[model samples]
Target: MIHTDVTEPQDFLVALGGNMPSEAGAPGDTLQAALAALAEAGADIRAVSAFYATPCFPAGAGPDYVNAAARIGAAMTPEAFLALLHRIEARFGRERVRRWGQRTLDLDLVACGDAVLPDADTFAAWRDLDPAAQMERAPETLVLPHPRLQDRAFVLVPLNDVAPEWRHPVLGRTVSEMLDALPAKSRAEVLRLP
Candidate 1:
């Protein structure tokens, strides 16, 4: 939970994704409202990415997603920030139904510290993985360099929009560099909000 060494002013990235709302107004409005809620919860919003409309993951369940990223400076631990994220999502009517499924909001803690995590399973799963591996193959760890970071243009393009200079802890690639390496189809569906 205490992921960063820096205190108070550590720069952390928060990513949000949701499909266009059935209600009036732009899809990005959902993200903006969420960001404002985060701010109201006491995190400092440093910067934000433009909205990126990209095809849904796992293919075909709903329309494309409106995704965006943000940089925040907070005094709380990663766990506290995650709690705040959930609160904001609830305020905006996020429902937990399916994985990568449609929703009113989805706040992902993509990265926390400068050091990439080798364990990201829910706290309980991470602990069990180390102890239970001998009994059976534990679920794969949720290491961050996210494994999918470079491959998913939805993650990369919006990430680049906000944190182009963010360097991969292991790969040393900037967001832009990783983005450039992705296949054309990778980001082929990502369109910047006008």
Candidate 2:
């Protein structure tokens, strides 16, 4: 049940990532479950990117990841939305055992409304980094213009596939623009999710 007295409808960005399920769960399963969970939490998904499998950063000892990005309209603050995401992750059996380790679910509130995160706390650190740093150290903050929105082809490509017209409030760039800005090497591994 969602409490809706505190906010109005606004767009949100959610990114998903996780390695092959071991004792956790399947990537696809987690992604879909997250979608349903988000909907249940009061956000209506407006667009969803096709799943993209990519190697985890920092070269971890994990399997290839299945990732996606979603655009949603909800009546919740960024903080509330993030809290709900963690709850959904916990329901899917995710545990903080390893940094960038495999998991059954990983729903990240990559952006919220039109507000840029301005803090550097555990819940808001990435709010101040550039695009590359945000991608390199995600799960740190759900800041927007998604500090790394313009650099990670993994995110840009999927986001373009889903919402080409989506624009960054702070940078004044569209999803296509962001994708166009990624380095060639960063854009290499992404493909159209079927």
**How big is the positional error of residue 188 in model 2, measured in Å on the Cα after superposition?**
2.6
* TM-score of each model, in listed order: 0.78, 0.80
Shift in Å, residue 175, candidate 1: 0.9
Tens-digit per-residue lDDT, 1-194, candidate 1? 22343466556777788885723235578888888777776678888888888887767878788988888888765666666778777777787666566887878776665645554444334433453352344224434444456667888888997889888766678889999999887777888878
Each prediction's Cα lDDT score? Answer: 0.71, 0.72
- Reference-based lDDT, residue 5, model 2: 40
Q: Candidate 2: where is the Cα deviation over 4 Å?
A: 22-25, 119-142
The clash numbers for all candidates, in the given order, read 0, 2
Cα displacement (angstroms), candidate 1, residue 190, comes to 0.4
Model 2 lDDT per residue over 53-80, tens place: 7777546677777889998887777777
Best by TM-score: 2
